[model samples]
Target: MLSVYVDLALGLTVSFLLLSLLVSGLNEAVVRLLSIRSKFLWAYLRDTMDGSDAQGRSWLPANPGEVFAALPFTRDPRPQHSDQPSPAQPGELPEREDKAEDAMVKLLYQRVQEIDHPKSGRTSIANIPPGRFAVALMELAASEPDGVEGFLGKLRSMGSPLYGHLKGVWETAQRDLDRFRQGVETWFDGEMQRLSMLYKRYVKWVVAVLGLLVTLVFTMDGLEYAKTLLRDNALRASVTAVAGAGPGAYEELKARCGGDDPVRCVTETLSQPALVTMVDHALVSVSFPAEGDPVVRWNGGAWWDRITTPSHWPGFLLTYVALLFGAPFWWDVLRRVTGLRSRR
Candidate 1:
């Protein structure tokens, strides 16, 4: 019993350990894959933006003429001016030119003020209202020789450092993801192999247990058979006759008793030495009538039928306990093997 308990405990411990390893490996693989995906997304977005610093650093010139020169020719066709209109040249200014110059100066001043007081809620070319920044960049790109294609080529050649940083992270993460996936697959395969091995082992154990149970059941039947034989008066009479007891001795004993009723049968059976010896032999050989009973006589049933009756609760309980303890490990092994087969 102690050996059986130890074997069961060992089997359960191994099964739990295998399950834990498989779960932990799968969890790590999932986390690594998610991390790789996140890095990939970040790299893609950074590449798309061309690494323009997201901190709102101003790149445009403070001078109006510089701003005008930077704007596409289609938007600002006038020649750039170096200095403010002089008093002597005031009369040279056309009404439309003066208004255009005032608008340009005001736009430049607003841009400069936004740069100086960045904390103040304001917008720049990068954060142009609504879809205007997109339109402006598109216009600038289009004004170039190869339009957006040329701009993209330059951006790629320049190699945005942000993309490099993100790429490094992504590559590292991807390698880890691949390794984790391989490990998980390997772990899963190993678990399946272990389960297969354990299943075969469990089946062997089950067969042995079943054989023991069958043997115990048959032994109990044999014990009941011997008990029945001891209780048979005809058999006992023949034995007594062979032992030189007179023929009338057996016949007169039965007649005096008027037949075998419980009380009279016991009294007559106890009086015969040969019958007592035969009963003792059967009791000793069968080792039945256990400790509590110490004596068992036939009750008009076959050995198997009597053994299976309510009196055999101890044997039944023991068999049930063995099955209960062994079944879970057996079931887990079966389930794992089935899963492996389905995957294959």
Candidate 2:
């Protein structure tokens, strides 16, 4: 009986975790689809490339999109303006000779070639050096008459977190061009690391908040489920039997929920999974409390009466906290619990 109880608890907990993970993964998918993180990075990169210190001058394109569109790092560069004639019909004419979508190549061939090196009095973007991205951008920033000071002023305008940290380093190394260049590169690297950390932290908070909302909707009262099992012998047996074999039902779970990746998961990518399916399965295998059992019919008037009752709030709270532990953590617990069953 005790083993059965343990199995029931472990099985249900694992299910809850899996469902929670599905929710969390979908939430992340929404964020990625909206390109929120990319937009932030794009802003950071924009400030770096297009920033100007001169009264009205900049060596690079002003728009972040345009800058990325003109870069080799990007896959689809923007098309450049051309004087070539256009084909009138579909499949009626041969391919156009001008491939203006090579914005980056045109940039390198034209703009980079137009700028003269302050020291060598020569023009070249590729010949500057083959190294880090930040180093290359800094060299471009220096292509203008104002030089390194132009880049420094741009960083200062943003009031970036690193700006304060780099104050002393900048002051000490400003005289040596090599050291100043290194310091700027270090600053860029630090900003990216900080952004990465903040982005991770943001995702965690999203999970917690989304978990709370999902638990409420599912009416997953952990206490109610526990109480239902403890006091009813028939219900306990049914749930225990199902749960003992729950590990074997993993393929069914996957088939229902689809693949692990949220993108390929069942149903809509961002829409919440039919959590009512989870609730129904649990109730069928476990049954509700005797007084509240759906089979017996009661004055409560609705099926959710079993969950929406104020008495179940505490259990709901527990479930909410459990959800925050995430799928990975619960998966580990489920593995250990099932391993013990196999051993016995």
Clashing pairs in 1: none
**Model-by-model lDDT, in order?**
0.36, 0.49
**Weakest ten-residue segment in model 2 by summed lDDT:** 86-95
* lDDT per residue (tens digit) for residues 241-304 in model 2: 5466765444444444444632244223223222333464232323344366545223233445
lDDT of 1 by residue, 1-344 (tens): 35434434444334333333433354346434333222222222232333322343222223333322332221222222223322221121122212222222232222222222211122121212213323333343344466444433433454433224323433544635334334434433454455445434433443444534433433232233234434444445544553687666666556645665534564445554332333232212332432574455543345455345776545444433443334445455545644434344
For every model shown, the clashing-pair count is: 0, 0
Q: Which stretches of candidate 1 lie over 4 Å from their true place?
A: 1-185, 193-216, 219-302, 319-344
